[model samples]
Structures are given as structure tokens and as C-alpha cells.
Target: MKLHELPDELHDLVHYSLKGGSEDFPEMRQFLGVTVRGDANLIWNKYKKLAKHEDKTAWREWVAQRKDSTAARREADEKRELLETRRRQIEERLLEAGWEAADLKFKPWSDGIQQWHELVEMPKQPRPLTDRVWKNLYAKLKPLLETNREERIEREYIKRKIRRRDWLEGVLYKLKRTEPPPLLKVKPRQSNSETLSSVFRSVTKRDVFPFVHDALKLPLIQQMNEDDIGIEEFREGIKEHQSKVEDFITDWQDKTRVYLVNLIQEEDREYSEILQPPKNMDLDAFARLSDDQKLLLRADSLFYVDTACFRTLMVDQPYDYGTALQTAYPSLPEYQPYDLGTEPVYEPEAPDLTVIHRYATAQEVARDLLEDLGKPNASFVEVNQLHYSCQRCHDKSARDWTSMLEHYINHKQIQAKVDKHASLLAEEGIVYRNVHDRSFSNDRPMIKPARRSSALGARVPVKMCKLCERKPIDLNVTLSIPRLEKHLLEVHNVNDPKPEVHYSLTLASMFGPSPGSDYEIEEPDEDNEEVEADNAPEEVPVEYYWPESSELEDEGEEEWAESDLQ
Candidate 1:
């Protein structure tokens, strides 16, 4: 039981505390002294034996916990106070607004007082007013608003639609630049301690490259050493391989961006003048985000914010908001979306009852067609929610709109089915219901087609390659959807079609009659295996031993001479 005769792990802890310049150790000396006492040892040994513990691991863990708790407790207390303060403030707002208790159900952001996540989590979480919490509040407000002042609710809704129309008009003018219709509203992911209790909670921080980062920090990677292993070439190989990787990544990124621009552009041509990305991306945000650009979207972006807060004292009064809004803005200030250019003039046409949307995906086109077929009540599903298995990839959710579109299109036999469906719906007397319908007919995309750098060349060519676009050579690369998709996933690390990813999509087909037969897509397991194999080579650099440039012409002659000599 002598302290000196204690186990090395225990003795070392004491030794580091007492002998080394680790810290002033009077308490540590006492902490070490008690371990050897017969009376103390009896209880400790019994606890260890009963617990079936063999080593000082338990004691080590206790010391670690003690250290963490000492510092963390105070911080936790301060944070809890702040949270409680915010909670109270929210509660006060709720009381003032006369909200029901059920309307403001909050998921406890912190467990009691102590939070280990603040220290352990890479990106810390913001607790107050998360999107889910806000939505909960909004949901409650919506019911109240509808009940108390239905007219105001409807009026505000109209105003939003009008505002949105103005925004789209701005996009075509290029006076106020435009952004493509968001496929999914994305938000920055928030860090959370995983739990089985299912509750919708808004994320304040999410790791975009969690798997990549974890793999990079593995112990095996940390152990790599050129001098110790006598493999100096290993380090060189890593550096060389990384260089090739960076180059490949750059090329893939450029290709992905161009592909997106092209896709969205096609959408404008097919439907109406739609939003396109700014030709010159202000790289300030891109540089700041780096790989995390995908995860940097706002938390509230999950759902489109259809309602704007009109926080006038007039709104607080028990009066119709619609009347109040109209009264406040009287003439509405002669609103126009663009100030830089005069609005273009074009002759209007009669409303086409055949609900044709120039959407960038098969799902959208299908949805529009379905709506035209008197199925307008179909709810919009979020990108994160759609989980249908893809038969072409032979894998579940390669996680891109293109992959989703490929699966959707393949089943329907693209081009042929589109016309057939339209005709089918038309025969059934299904009137079109456009999502972008507004108060005035002027809300529709302009009659004048949007101007683009490639004016006449903006058409989708036949037999397109989705993966690689060879402008003049392979103009119609996207027509081969399966081939292009396979190549994109295998070569580029691009998987999901996120808002952050500068990519676009458009459906193309020679619409006429339903063909005699469906387009037979060959599903070969071998092709998938080959593509997967090719993807493996991306991790390593390709090394080619090249002969001198001067010797290039004589190399074939030299080989022949050597063969003759042999």
C-alpha cells in the first residue's frame, strides 16, 4: 500500500503532480497519499472489485471529469442564465401576444446547466430563436392571424406574390442580377448531441465535411513517418498525390459550376426568363467558406419565408392588417423591380391552360403536369425529405437533383411520356395551376426571352453528355443522362445538388408522339463496378516515367533495334 509501490499509472499521476513542474501539488500529494492508506484502499478495492475494474483507468477518468467539471460548471451556469433570460423574454413576448402554452413548445437547448458540447463540438451552437422554434411561433401566429384578421393575412400574401414577381422581372433585366429558383432551402447545420427522442429542432451549426475531416485525423494517419518506417518515398508520394488531387478537384469544380450555369440557362429558354447566377461571383464569401460553403446557408432557409413581419404599432391594434397595410402605403410608391434599365415591352399572349413549367428537374415538370391534371393539391416535398431509391445507379440516393431526375425520367421514358402525359391531361380537361400565379397577369415570366451570352446557341442539342461538355464537339452531351451521371459521381466529388453548388439542370426532348416502345436503359452491374474502381484511383497520383523530349522520335527505332539484337 506504500505510495512509492503504487501502480505506475497511479504513481506517475502523483509524480507528475508532485515532482514535475506540472502544478503546485499539496492537494495532489494528499490525493496520492490517500490511495495507499489501508482504510482508504479497503473501500477503494471493494468498489473496484464489485465494479469488476482491473486498472487505474476508472481513477484516471474521475480525475479527467473532475478537471472538466471544475472549469465547465461556471461557464455552464453563465450560459444557462443567458438561456433562461432569453426563455423568459420569449415567454414575455408570448404573454403580451396572448399565445397559448401549446403554441410555444421549446426543445430544451441545454440539458439542465452543464453542456460538454461547448468544448467538444467543433462549431458551437446558437440556442435562441432557431428556425424550428421560429416556425413553431409562426405556426401559432398563422392560426391567430387567420382567426382574428383573415383579410390582412390574404392581403399580405398577395403583396408577397407581387414582390416575388418583381424580383423575377429584375432577374431578366440583369439590372438587379438574379438567382435560380432554390430547389431546396438549405441552412447551416448546427451541432447537437445525438438523441433518439424525435423532435424537430433547428440546427445552428453542421459540419459539411465531417467524414472527410474525421478520416484525415485518424490515428493511422498520425503515425505515418518517413524516417521511422524507412519509407522516405511515402512522404513524397503523399505530397505528389495531394498536388494531383488539388488539380483534379479544381477541374471538377470548374466543370460543375459551368454545368450548373448551363442547366439553369436551359430552364429560362424552355419556360420563361428565369434567374441565373451573377456572371462574376464575388469570391469574398466563397474564399471565406472554402469547403464549408455548402453548410453556410442561413438556418431559416429550410422553408421559404412567405410571411414578412409588419411590426407597426398599427398592426398591434385589433384592426385588419390588409386595410392597415393598404392605408399605410396608399399609392404603394410606384414599385418596380429594376432601376438600372427601362422595363422591356412585349406583346402578351393568352394563358396556355396546359400548365407547362420550365422547371430544371423531372420532378418539377411531373408536378406541373400533375397540377394541370387537376392534382394541384399535391404538397411540395423538401429536398432533404425525398428518399426514393434510384434503380439506374444501383445505389440509394447518390444525392443530387440529376440522380433524382435520372431515376424519375428513366421510369417514365423521358421525351415521349412528357407529350403523352400532356395530351392525356388535356383529354381529361385538366386546367393548369401555376405556383407563381399572382394578382396581375404581368407576374408571368416576360414574353421577351431572357438575353444570354450564347443567344442562338442556348438550345439543348441532341445526344448530350451530362458529365463533360465539349462545346462545339459534343453539344448534346446531356442526352446521355446515364453516362454523364456515372462519370460525374465517379470523377467529381459532387454528390448532392445543394443551393451552394453552382449547378443548373433542364429537361430536353423532341416532344411529339408517344413512341412505339419505351427507351430501354441498360442497367449493367459491371459498368457500376468499373465506375467505382475508377473512383479509387483519384486518391493516388498517376506517375508516368517520360523519356527525354529529344529522344521521343528515336524511342520507337531504339526499341526495334533492341528487339532485333535480342
Candidate 2:
């Protein structure tokens, strides 16, 4: 009979019988014309008894125990192989280092083993390797060791030192001496006459200048004869002779003053050198004040301005007779002037009144008032009135005009509506309000339609959200991933599979019961009621079950029989 035609009980028996002795079943073997060893029916009966009536639990326990034992044995074998490999590698390295097999001895301890060369004896007074020997060894061994090996060697040398304490102290001392000193704390000071004189003497000693001749040149002095001349001629002759004499005296005096001032300025170097101040004088101070102070002091003493003949229109006039005398002769230092108080008098500048007048102009007045109202553009009445005033009159002209205009505009209610819309937009992050200016309100508007451009030829429709039915004002939400994941799972009842959890779910599914179904919404917890509302799902019936041991055994028997046949 065909397998399917047999009764269920008989079929199960035949299946198990064939399965148990599949390799050695005589009936199956004869049917297939292959070699067979045992009865298939008998083998199947044994397995059937084991599955149903036999002590199955104990047999399972025995099988598990055998598997564990086999795994443990294999693991031990693998570990032994690894240890053997590592031992071989270590031995090879030692052998390469010139340790012969006979010379090497290993002593095993409780923790581990130590290897030593029996042929090599400890030296009592071991001498350090000569430079030549050390260099040769290093040249050969450096390629074999890592960069950190040099540091290890040095540390070993230090540790093996005969007088370690003294050696360390000497090294520290040498290091300290080699270090550079901290920067000097002193600031520069000004040079004086003594310093300048010393510098001059040094320069002279270097033979900087040599003059061939040392004679003075003189011009003849003449008196005009006015007695025999006409009235005009005589007057002209006197004037001409007086001018010549005055010019000569002025030129000579100016030259002499300049020479003396230079000499005094030169003496500053000598004075500075002799004093030996803590710091050098700044070059800027020397250039600006040094020559000026020296000249002033000299002129004060002689009661005259130096280089009086060279004076231009811009020069200040002599303050007193002392200044005038000093200008004529700089060398006479004994003639000192009366002291004036050192307090500086600063002349205040006159204020520009034009600024006030300019502000009163119609354009300026309007602009200023507009600015105060927080508006820059004069054409925009809303902004201008908030910030600025009337261009013509400040108080009288604009007060009524602005009030009437503002009243009319407010009556229109456009500003109020705009403000309300702007506030709404701000909540959505579409616009931001200016906190500083109360009148201007929010800078950005809610809906900014795309502008048509001829260059582009066509305009595209603006993108917007479907649920909120408004374009996302600011699409960027700053919630963290974990919080978002929790929101999706708790609010929507969707199970999102983590990399670690082998299940599939989407963010949208997690947020709700079914995809696009408003039927099964999850309610928010009592604690999260203040947060966004998560609607509850409609109620539905669900069933669960538990099977009896008899039913489980019968099912297991059937499965076992089928498996045996296969």
C-alpha cells in the first residue's frame, strides 16, 4: 500500500520504524535492493517508547551533560596548543640572543618559570662596556628593539649605578646650571648730558673727523657817507648800511646759538653713561623731550630764545626779558629767569553751534523724530511715526498730525492684525519679535509668498505641511533621539526594533496602533497630561490560551515519529 493510504496510527508506526533503522532497515533495504542490518520496525518501536513512555527528562539531561564535557575537552586542547606556540616563540628569541640549549636552565615556581644561562656567571666588580664595544652592540641590536628600548636601557643603567644618590644629584645640578636665567625686571631710563659727553669722547677717540685749516673769515665793515647825497639818497644809504650790519649780527648769533645747543645736547650721553641707570632711555623720549628741555633751560637762564633770528611767524614770542637775552647768547647760563609754576594750562576749544542749527532743518528734524520712533524709511508711516517726528516743527506741527494719523491707522486695524499674526508666527519660530523696541513689533511676517521672477520663467508652489496645514515655520526640532524614540513608542504604540532587538517597526507605527488608522490611539499617562495629547484607542476584545500536558505529549510524539522517518 502507498504511505498516505495507511491508517494514521499504522502510518506513524511505519514512518518511525523506517526512520529508526534507516541505515540498516531490512524491509526498506530489500525494497530499494540495498544492504540492510536490522529490523526497521523494532528500532522505531524503541524511539516511540523513549518519546512517550520512557524517562525523557533524564535522557535529555544526560545528552546535555555529555555535550558540555566534549566542549570543555576541545577548549582545553586549543589552550594547550596556544601555550605551546608561545613557548616556542620565547625559546626562539632566547636562542637568537646566543643562549645555547645546554647553557640555558629553567626553574619553575608557583607563579611562573624563570630562564637563566648556566654558563654565564655573575661578575663581582662588573666594568661598563667600552664606547667602541657599546657602539658595535647598539648598531647590531638597535634594529631589533623598539624605540622605548633605549629609555629602558638608560633606566637600567641608572638603577645599576654604584653611587646612585651622588650621580643623580650631579645630573640635577648640571641641568639647573644649563637652564637660562629669567628675563631682567628693569625698565629703561632717560639719557643725560654726562652720557652724551662720554659717547662723544669715545667717538672722538676713534678719530671720526679731521679739519685741514682753523682760521676765521672776516668781512669789512663800512659806514655810508650821507652828507654829500640827496635827501632820498641819504635816507636810502643809511637804511642799506643799517640792514647789512643787522643781518650780519643776526646770522652770527643764530649760528653760535645752534652750535651751543648741539653741544649741550651731546653732553646728555656723557651724563647718562656716568649715572649708570637701571634701564636705557626710550628712543621716543629722547627725540621728543631731550633737545627741547635742554634748549628751554638754556634760553631761560640767559633770558632769551635760542635761534631768535631763525624764528618764523609760527614761533611763540619771548615770555620775558630772560627769554630775549637767552636767544642772543646761549652760553651765559648764570643769568637765570624767575620761576613760573609748573601747572599746565589747557585752552578749551569753542563748541560748534552749526550742529544745533542743522538739527533744526526740516529734513533733519523729520529724520531725528523718525529715528526716535524706531523707523529709518520716511515713506513708511507705521515705522516712521513709531520712531520719528515732523520734519518742520517738533512739538506743535507733528503732535496733532501724528495723533490723527495713528488714530486712523489703528481704526483700520491692520497694525493690530499684523501684530497678532506676527506673535503667532513667533510661537512657530517663523518670526522673531524685537524685544528692545515696543512699537516695531516682530520683524518677520507669517506668510511670505514666493515672488515671481521673469529670469526663472515659472514659479513653483510653496511647500506646506498637511496635518497642521501650514508650511513648517522652523522644521528643526531639538529633541534628543532617545526622547523621540520614547515618544514614538509610548504615544503611537509602535515597536521600533533596535539593532540589538531583532524586530521591525517604524516611527509612525510606534506613535499609533495601525498605519494611518485614527481608530487605535494611545492615551497619555497621568504624569504627561500637561504635554501634547495622545488620543486613546477604541476598545476591542483579545484572547489568550494555555495547552494541557497530555495534548503536548501527543503532539511531541507525532513530531518525533515524522522526524524519525525523515
Candidate 3:
């Protein structure tokens, strides 16, 4: 082919060869079908020179871009290596300064410094003046240390805030792309007159504004231009609307609670806490207690009603209840508001285990799992290797906790049962089992590993795209499960990939060399005198023994027989 007409890969290969990619010009000539004898070397050299000039002239701009790309990659690698080296140096310095890893894990910096100073001075038995000097130095350094600590914390807080804001914006963008949650509505009271008017009115997004506002607390920025209101006046407008939203939510909650109270009273199912005061408490105290406090004492019933009411107010859709709950009470640390102070202690919200008259929805299943995990906001990654299977479905297939929630929601039969409130009639059984447990059927499908933050030292599991296996591509490109899904979407034009159908897990090797292989203790060769001598018993070295106490009288019974042992 003509040099200009050559395929891009071949042209690039020739260019690479000219750029010192290969040493053998004769081999290049043979590869390019320029094989002959005699003047082939001179011809090849001339061809290479001409090719170099042509390639450079023709693709000068592209060559520069390639050079820039290569430079960027080189710079990134160097930067990463530098960062790694710096981390190692810091660790070494910490060790040398007698600081434990835990000392620096959570710190004000002064604590570690103090601990290190103590470690250094404790064995010295220093003079009083020297001790005072060290103390003075610490006193002078303390303010600077505290200042540095505050600055560090502030930087981290700002970083966290930026990350959370970006994440929220991304989520909001995604939410905009998907279908909006079902609007919550309530039927109005019927009229006594003959006019049969419809009571149903679709609730606007404004009705669920309070919970969303409380949950996300997204920033409100004014539009650039307005006829009457300036940017400064927007805050006042928002405050007025906010007050109205809060009042609406409070009124709705009060009416809902009254309905719940009446229902519980009719059923005679209210706990003692809800019914009467304790024997130790006076009637005045009982009367003074708020209804919420009283209900909180019997939290199970309250939680059940709370969850149901939240769902009713938020989405009014069975499948979307869990998503609404997640938005309202985000469990992930990143999703949480950045706290400048020490982490606020949270009382674990126990699951409402009191079986309702309905089959569990995705919301309830997720809540139960969260309560069990003792981190109501945690993701499926926390419960590593565990998968949930529905006994009611009678399918051996398992799913990760998040996917399990989705399964329950999407199951038509389960949704029907849930709608009819007849799940309690059946067992409503779901069990979580470890995927790695051999006792379970080997033929059972694997659950996708949860995606985790790319923290240093995190061991991400590998997954191979099953789609790639069927395609004309390299089969060895194993990625993390999340990355595999992304790869399928980007490269294979596949969306909504199933873990079992679209991907296969590549678990890390657990089996090492057998016990009797390289690690086995070998039998000694007694036949060789040299081997016998090598295996002969030896006395404990004198250096290894503790020094004799100065108080003990020195005995001359032991003779010095030191020789060159080194």
C-alpha cells in the first residue's frame, strides 16, 4: 500500500520504528516486504529517512497531541509514585518518633506530639531544668499545633462539603432524567347532596417539600434577572414559603397520628406505655408527657406508623418508598452533612418486627436489613459476601441486599400480595446467606459485589464481563463489578445488566501451596557428618541472655570461650 494509504495501525507502527521503537532495520525491511539482498540495507535506510520526514510532515499536529498525551501519562505516574514515596516516608518518620498508627488516625496533632514526647523522655531520667525546657517548648508549640489542627480540620470539612454538594448535584441530575416519584394525594370528604363530585386531586411536589428540604437542604440560588424581585429579596421569599411548608407538614402529621391512634384504640393493640403511666410516675407527669414521647416509649408501633405515613406523604408508591426513605435519611457517610464537630452519637433505630397484615415491601425489607446491620444508612457493601434469597419465590438465585430490595418491589406476585395486605397469611420468608458458603448449592448464581470508595489498601473484587466472552475481544480484562457494568454500557451498548447473566465473578485465589510442598519441614540427612554437625544442638548465645543484675555477686565459675561466630 502507499505510505499515506496505509492503515493507521501500520503507519503508526512504521512511525514508532523510526522513533527508535525497534533496533533491527533489516527485520523492519523484511516485515514491510522489502526483502532482497545487496543494496536492500541502503534502500531500507533511505526509505526509513523519507518515511520519517513524510510521517512528521503529514501528522505533525497529531504527533504533538500524542506526545502531549504521553507526557500527561508520564506526569501522572510520576506524581503517583511521589505520593506513594511521601506516604512511606511519613510512616517511617512516625515509627521513628515512637508514634503508633492509632495515635495519628484521629487527632488534634497535639495528642500524637505529646505521646511521642513522653515516649522519648520517659526513659531518659532527665534533670529538672531540662524537663522544664521541654515543657516550655511544648507550651510554645501547643498553640501552633492547635492552630494547625483547626486548619487541617477546616480543610477536610470544606473538601467533604464540596464532595457532598457535587454528589447531590449528580443525584439531582439523575433524578431529573428518571420519572418523578408518584404524587401523594388524599380523598376529600363526601358531600350529603346528590352531586357526585370526584374527591381525588393530585398532590403537587410542594406537598412533600418539607421532608425533602429537611433531608437534602440543597442551596437555593436566585435567577439572574427578574422584573420585581432582586437576588437579596429571594431569601425572604424562601423563608415565607418554608414556614408554610413546615406548617402544612405538621398539620398533615397531626391528622395522620390521630387516625393511627383511633385505629390502634379500635384494635386494642396499643402498648401499656401508650395506654397508662408507670406505677412510679404521678398522673401530672403522665399528663405532661407529649404524645410523641408516649408513642416513642412503644417505638415499634410508632415506627410502623411512621414508616407508613412517611411513605404515604412522600411517594404514595409501594416500590418507591425505599428510595424516598433513602433520600430522607441517607445512611452513607458521604451523603451525610459534613460535621465539623465530633461525630454525633446516634441511637440505633430498631426495626419494627411486629408483623403487619401485609407482605413486606422494599422499604420494610431494607429497613430490617439496616437495623440488623446496626447502621440504618449503610450500603450493601457493609454486609460483604452476604446475599438474600426469597423462600416464597422458591428460586435458588440470590441478590445483593440492594438488589434484593429491588426484586421484592419488582416481583408482580409479591406486589399483588402486598397490595392486598395478605402477606402475613404466608410465611413471607427471606434469608441472607454467604455466597462463599460451600454448604449452599454450587450451581446458585453469585451476587454482584458492592462498589466501594477507592481508599488506599481497599481490596476490590474482580468481575469479568460475560458479554465480552461472546464477542470478538480479549477475555482477560477483569474489572470490578461496578466497572464491568459501566464497561458493558459504554462498549457493548448494554444497559441494565444482570450480575448472573452479564457478568461472572473472578474471586481472589484463597488456595496457596499445600502444607507439605515448599513450606514443609524437611527430614535431616543423618548419613553426612557435615549434615549431622549442621543439625547439632547449639547453646543459647550469651548476647541473647539478659544481663546479670548488678546486685548479684559475680561468680568466676563460667569461663569465657568466645570465638568468631559471625
Best by TM-score: 3
For model 3 the TM-score comes to 0.20
Q: Model 1, 107-166: lDDT tens per residue?
A: 122121122222111115435665676556555444443332333332333333333223
Residue-level lDDT of model 3, residues 1-566, one tens digit each, is 23333433333333221222233453453244321233334434544565577456645555455456645654565455445554455445545656444333333323345543442323233323344554554465345445445544554444333333333333333332232221211122122011221222111111112233232332332121122232124324434555553455465445544543443344444333342332233455346545643442221221122454455442223222223333334333332222434465231232322322122343454544444434343322223123444433222234445445555444433334333543432343211222222233334332322222122333445566665453122234455555556566644456777776767665444573322121211111111111000111223332111112211112213222222211
Measured on C-alpha atoms, candidate 3 has an lDDT of: 0.36
- Candidate 2's residue-wise lDDT over 8-89, tens digit each? 3323233221222342454452233221224334533554565574668864554455456645654565445445554455
Better of 1 and 3 by TM-score: 3
Over 4 Å off in model 3, which ranges? 1-228, 239-246, 252-566
> In model 3, which range of ten residues has the least summed lDDT?
526-535
Q: Say which prediction, candidate 1 or candidate 2, comes out ahead on TM-score.
A: 1
lDDT of each: 0.30, 0.28, 0.36
Q: Rank all candidate structures by their lDDT, best first, as comma-separated numbers.
A: 3, 1, 2
What C-alpha lDDT, on a 0 to 100 scale, does residue 300 get in candidate 2? 17
* Candidate 3: residue pairs that collide: 331-377
**Deviation (Å) of 293 in candidate 1:** 10
